[model samples]
Target: MDRETRYEDSHVSIGSFVLESGEELPHVELAYERVGPSDAPVILVCHALTGNQFTIGEDEPGWWKGLIGKGKYVDTSEFQIVTFNVLGGCNGSTGPCSINPTTGLAYQADFPFISVRDMVHSQKQALEQLGIHHLHAVIGGSLGGMQVLEWGILYPECMDHLVPLAVTPSLSAYGIAYNSISRFAITKDPEWKEGYYNLEKPPAAGLATARMIGMISYRTDDMFQKKFGRKVKGNPGESHTETTYDVESYLHYQGNKLVGRFDANSYLYLLKAMDMHDISRGRDSIAKAAKLIQPNVLAISFKGDLIYPPHELEKMFSLESMAHFYIVDTKFGHDGFLVEFDKWGPLIKQQLKETLKI
Candidate 1:
């Protein structure tokens, strides 16, 4: 495995698994990172798109260190935190990039479509195989947040608490629109080869452009203006003559960063899963979807998030009489819940206190 893509993590074979679409995977493997006490209430930390099972690190810096540290919202002393690379993810998990045992080639375009429910079911199978029948909570943001809601809907009694941050019951039309454009950027690229590209000639430009599009949606316009304005990206003392905008430079940097570590097909598949994430699809209505969530729900909404704005979450969770909701006022947009710790971190701690009595 390329170091840029990923190295192996703690893995558990989940045997044969069937997706919600009736597609069956002959064998499934889930790569995860578990930390904290050996015997303690479990806190399942789901990762966002493009993220892996490196939430709480040993020799490396964990992705959510600011929020999952020693004295952070999810205090490790009181709970064991386990995070897994989503089933359709490339990071040490079975994904479009993984080999299909029957064909002895990467799944690629041949990989069956998966939904958020499929991801939740696979994770549940993996956990149960490891003798974990119950969970303390499911914590995640954005893509991870979608998984959190799916876990609550699919296996309501499997967890005590559900902390879904910056996400709604389903990806809004606006969100899907963004995903559609991103996928188009990848599929149209010549090097993409219709999802059959090898490692040597991956769709670098297309994936990078898709990531650039995603970077814009992740943060707010106000944030970009405040951070970069109309400044030129160049040397400190260099003359600003026909130079790239600072904001453009930042987007390019983010795009390149993802292209280096992520598989383009995995990105497309995950986006499709997100698009198929509607608890109401088979259940009839969002109200019914809310009704299926038996666990204590604590969902956070962001005022600056334009993609899946706070009003959408407010309207959906409103269907559930007992669901707790918090709206944080921040300038960071959809990524705020993932970036700024002070805003939503305390809310998580409070929820943990009420649910776990810690």
Candidate 2:
């Protein structure tokens, strides 16, 4: 738990990892960032679909710095925080963009399909190599949250608590529909060329469009109406067809920003992995799968999230005997879990202080 400031050399190769699809990766390297006291309770912080291992930065603050820092909600001074880039990510982690040992070329479309279970298994393997056999708690939001749930189900004895924010036990049909459209946006792009596009001229337009589609579902219409409304650059009646909505412009900016840094192939792989997220996929019955979860659970949902609405969480957690559920309102919808820390930070802090004593 020596302080890691988003630097390099913090990786472990879990060799010849077999994926859920019965395919094997010759080498699966995981990049991780660990922070806080070496002897303190370890808190595994899982990143979302597009996030990396930098849970807390030194020169620059990390993404969740507001609620997880030296003296933030989770209090790094008292507990260790570890974050790792998920498989199929564009970051330092071995992903679709990584060179395939067989051909010395990027995996691209040739990358084998992976599921959430595969991601959890890979992380567990890496953790074992790093000498982290046990965790005090597992926490994350969105895709990260999905991983947290998987930990509780797959390795119940390895962790004592699970804190999943703004996520459901499984991806909903509505969520899958949105992801389908986004995947279509990327795969159908003329420049995609079956994910083997030239690195210099990747599928920027398609990737951007896919991100735009995601940005739409990540928030609520109520938030949009209040934040954007009918506002336009110039006069509203100047040119009806040409007047661009503020929301439309915002989405365009977000989409373009992701295109600059993220690999399209990685995005496609991660989206499919998310679509395959179900706690009971191989358990045969959801009730049987639920029986596998043994950790004390603290699940918080954003009231405005359209992707994983509060009801989805309620339906799944209702059967948990050791679960604590709370619905917090943040106008940002699904993205609220990343922002508006003030609305949900106290709930998590109280849970940790009251139960985990950290």
Q: Each model's C-alpha lDDT?
A: 0.85, 0.86
List of clashing residue pairs for candidate 2 = none
Give candidate 2 misplaced runs (Cα > 4 Å). Answer: 1-9, 235-243, 354-358
True lDDT of residue 143, candidate 2: 94
lDDT of 1 at 192: 90
lDDT (Cα, tens digit) per residue for candidate 2, span 1-358: 4343223238888888998888999999998888877777888999988788888876778889888987789888788888888988877888988899999999889999888888899999998987899998999999999999899998999988889988987899999999999899988889999889998899999999999999988888888899999887676667767637787789889999999989999898888889988887878866677778898889999978988989877777788898889898778899898888888899887777644643
* Candidate 1 Cα outliers beyond 4 Å, as residue runs: 1-9, 234-243
Task: Please state every model's RMSD to the true fold in angstroms.
Answer: 4.9, 2.4
- For this target, which candidate reaches the highest TM-score against the unseen true structure? 2
